[model samples]
Target: MTTRFDPRKALLALSAPVLAILVAVIVTSLILVVAGDPVGEVWSTILSVPRPRVVVSIINASIVYYISAVAVAIGFRMNLFNIGVDGQYRIAAFAAAVVAGEGWLPGPLNILLGLLVAMLAGGIWAGIAGLLKVYRGVSEVISTIMLNAIATILVAFLLRKVAFRTEGSNIISTTPLPEDSRVPGMAIIPDVSREVYGLLFLAVVVGFFYWFILGKTRFGFDLRATGRSETAAVASGVKVKRMVLMSMVLSGVVAGLVGMPLLFGQDHAYGSTFQPGLGFAGIAIALLGRNHPIGIIFAALLWGFLEQQSNALQITAGVSDRLVLIIQGVIVLSVVIAYEVIRRANVRFEQRKVAQALEEQESMTKEGAPA
Candidate 1:
């Protein structure tokens, strides 16, 4: 058998993305200087130890972005392009807020049920795309994109017609959810922000579960098999159609969870654009993390840190935050291209190994027969 890939080569391959990230950082820095801002001051602010509350917000933001990113990675692992997590998250939050507004349940239980509602709703929404792809051969990319537009429109219509129609608020949004619906928050570690600490605890749990589900479960294997080759999986008696549908549902559920931390964990009210475009960050986090859940945690933190510093860059380096946006876009695109290239190369290598093994078997058979 052909030797497996060299460990050093794999390490270097993994580091390639880090190198790109470093290069992007430098490029961003240079742009800041060119924009007439002082880089030194910006660097200082980014590295400076801040008071407890600000630190808490940063940690909270990191956890939020990281968890959402993990959700995105789940979909990507199954070969499903979940480009509409933004829509999924927003819609789920909307549903949670509606339930909260109705005051239909008690405190902690209401919060838990609201989260469940969001998770199920978002999963169902994404499942629609999965169904279309499986049954009609429609590309998920197209369907998910269309679903995003539909989600936005639906949210807008609901906000205007019912949820937050209070007097004189021009911006469309759902009304503030009742206090009882808020998820009880707590500090994770002593001396850390309570909210941040609680979120970190949740993050760890999610991370552990992510590993267990993807590594130890038969369902994960089926999903992987389907992603690698649907035809082969079907021949092996694995239900490829069901797996695809399940993948979308699972991914959507995770995306829905993203809404929970926001609605109950962070904000009690749901605004239309309260945190727009955060879901797309998952695409970057997935690529940067290489679709590994643990890696996504770090990648998400890095992106979050950069974003936190972005506003400081404006004041010190005179660079617009959009500069960060450009850099992130390029990074995501590069990761995607590189991932595709490596995947194809791996496939070719496997094919060659199979061919060589077959040839060796035939030669041995011939030699024995002649003897």
Candidate 2:
């Protein structure tokens, strides 16, 4: 039997983002007015985007954000909260940088080794939370949060004790990766001075795999089933503990990529100046995207655009860049509320449709028997 198209459900899904954006825009405009900023001017500056350089920067930034968000999304799909992504990627990058700096192999081999080190470091870090959850009955949420703090301390200690190296101007950083280990940037935009990240393709590949594995694989079915109802999944003979562990590790593997674009394409080393808070940002992005790989890409790009706009806002409107933070926070909150509301409405609509169909069938049966 063929299933009919669900326009109402489709509309409801689309409305979540649209309505949330509308609410955020309205609220942000009011705040801008109170702060003596011209809403129109601010938006104009943001939308103008200035130059090809700025566009390239946004795309590059979005690639990193995409990796981070997808990592968080993997955990989200399995009802696991891997808050330790921050720590996972930091340590992973540091270790990978240290290994890559050795430069003991051919260019391709060196790059592969660096990536392997990153994945191992991140997976091991995330596995700690998974182990605690499966064997010790600890909540992954609590364990992961604690692990984040521990990771910060551990990274600092390692940086000082082992990986410390002074670079130009006495900047503290891990040993810089050799040229052979670095991923070259792509000159995707013709005549643009800025080069797009080579690792952007990696993010796209990860997204494709995420969508395929989750939608078309048996493990994906078990993972989704367990997420929906653990008891039912257990009764169906799905291995809950193993699934949980696998999901967390898979999330960490992706989290390892979060630092690669910046590491290979720009920084070439892990340093004190490395960007932090991306893991937290990933959580917000994942929620905004509803944990779908394709959705996460758009969410990441939107976030990157907002971040890039902050500079324009600062220069053109003479507004504090912090205004972008307020906008982001409002957007995230509104999106969450909007999705929840839409979900409930959709559930009701489905229930009503089923009830009506049942009633119609019952009436038809009764008329045929009596007449």
Candidate 3:
């Protein structure tokens, strides 16, 4: 019984990312046409390597997606839906920014402390949902959703009350951190045409860590086992309760880190204007990528590309960025469908194999009985 490596499953996994990019392109083109902008310019924005700034923007977007995708994928692996990543990120970003904006601490140390605080903030925020699901037997989907709202309102309130200030006499909700606290540019790669390259290293590390946690660690085993079957896992003596809580916390920490680039690297502080939908975007990325670390990287990259070119759609094709969300919805729907198809096929294959084995054993027994 020689079994060949199945490429079909790989193809299925690849389909979502490919379809997402295609949808993005098509929508952008339509927008361009409607807006009286040349669709060619929009396409060029995405494909053409112009100056280093566009390249830098591309890199920044990619890093954000990669980081956030992994954060989403962690809860997915543990079978705990952590949908409040956006709120978690927002809260954490605010925490990091406030701490760094003081200019009261040294550069490297301040940055380190800022990130640590951000992680803690995100973990605590997510822990609420975890606690609800674990002890109260509440639905995580519901709890996380509500928690997102709560987190958003709370962060908004804090910015107004606690951090209700900005540099140079502005009435902004938050103060911008000094440049010294930001991640240094990629000094090693000169002429790379991008200043915000520190995150490239972070993205690489994130990928490796993601794969390692899911593929190498014992904790990963517990998470996967629980995800595969909670009943079986509990019977096998796995601490389902603890696993759920820890996984959610860890997932939130990763989500919190997503703000580093924006809060610390770019903006130097959290702002009310910063988009929170990135967390939702992370979910789309996780699903499209099949919750695999490597798959998430490509999915994130594709999403980043779509978003970057969205501006072009508005200018060149006269399309709106809202079209990007529509395209994302289509891609997500297709990915879900693909997943179901693959799951059903695998179940059928297993059933057939078991039936064949049982029949073979019966036939052998009858023959040996001398009939």
Candidate 4:
């Protein structure tokens, strides 16, 4: 059947971003005005990361951030919040780093071993929450939060007792992986200090797999159905508990990679100074993207840009770093409101169209009088 054109629906879809941007701009500008800062100038500074080096840095950062966001998105698709992704990845990376440091075989083999270890660690960690939810009726959120704290303490103890190594630079870290196992960066632009991360290819592969699984696979359908309504999905013959377990494991698998881009490509070791809070940032990005792979990429990029712009904001506009936080919060709130309004409008439009079709059919029936 041919579908009717939905002008209101189309307009609402486009207006969401527009409205969000307008709100964010107004709010941020007002904040700047109150602080006696030139609003236009501050905005200009935020947008000044168009330079080649800055752009490369943003891209590099986005690679890791995109993986982190995708990990979060997987859980969101199943209506589960895997909040312990930070703990999962950190512990996984540490364990992977220790394994990679033990040069047992050749370059490729060692790297493969490290990746496998990371995935195993993350999956085991997340599986605990899944198991608890299925068997004990515990909430995943509460269990995952507790698991994060446990993971942090466990890693700290391991680093001190088992995996610790003193580098020449006086930085205590997990033993470094061999150079041969490290992913080499691509110097895409000449005379630039930054090199595009070798793990960018890994991110692309992950994005493709995420799209394929969600858009094409049967498990994807069941996962989505469960998310929509667990009781209905269970009645439909879907094993909801099994789906939950599998989804959490899969989410953890992706979360395992969140640290690899930095671990294999940049740091080559897990240290006390390794970047944290990526999993939390992933939560925000996944929400912003609404759990689509392509959407997550753009969301991650925007988030990375904002993070990268913080330096420029401080240097050029003399603004506090907290301003970025304010803008981000406003944008997220605005988008959520816009989407809700659009959802209600679309529902009303669909109802009206159905009623009109029914009325037209009744009128046609009445005109065919048999008198």
Best by TM-score: 2
Candidate 4 lDDT tens digits, 1-371: 67899786667766876687689889999988988987987889887746778778888888988888888888889999889898889888988988898878689899889989998988888899999988898888999889989988888888877556574655678878898999889898777888989878889988999999987899899999998899999999999999999999998888888899888889998888889888888887877776878778888888888878876777777888778888888888888887788788888988999999999999999999686
Better of 1 and 2 by TM-score: 2
What's the lDDT for candidate 1? Answer: 0.75
TM-scores of the models, in the order given: 0.82, 0.96, 0.84, 0.93
How many residue pairs clash per model? 3, 0, 6, 0
Model 1 agreement with the true structure over 1-371: per-residue lDDT tens digits: 56787985586467657666766667656876787766677667665665565656667777778767877888888888888788888888788778776777787677777878888888998899889988999998899888989988888787776656458866556767777666666665357535563446666766787788987899888888778887899899998888988988888887876766777666676776567776888878878888887678778877777676665656655656666686777667666666666667777888998999999999999989954
Q: Model 3 over residues 262-317: C-alpha lDDT tens digits?
A: 77666666776675687888998899888887788778877876677666656655
lDDT of 2 at 7: 87
Stretches of model 2 off by over 4 angstroms after superposition: 1-5, 163-168
RMSD of each: 4.5, 1.7, 3.8, 2.3
Q: Cα lDDT for residue 186, model 1?
A: 67
Judging by lDDT against the true structure, name the best candidate. 2
Which 10 consecutive residues of model 4 have the lowest summed lDDT?
162-171
Question: Could you tell which candidate, 2 or 3, scores higher by TM-score?
Answer: 2
lDDT of 1 at 223: 82
lDDT of each: 0.75, 0.88, 0.78, 0.85
Runs with alpha carbons beyond 4 Å of true place in candidate 1: 1-10, 29-52, 165-173, 187-194, 197-200, 337-371
lDDT of 2 by residue, 224-285 (tens): 88988899999999999999999999999889878988888899988888999889889989
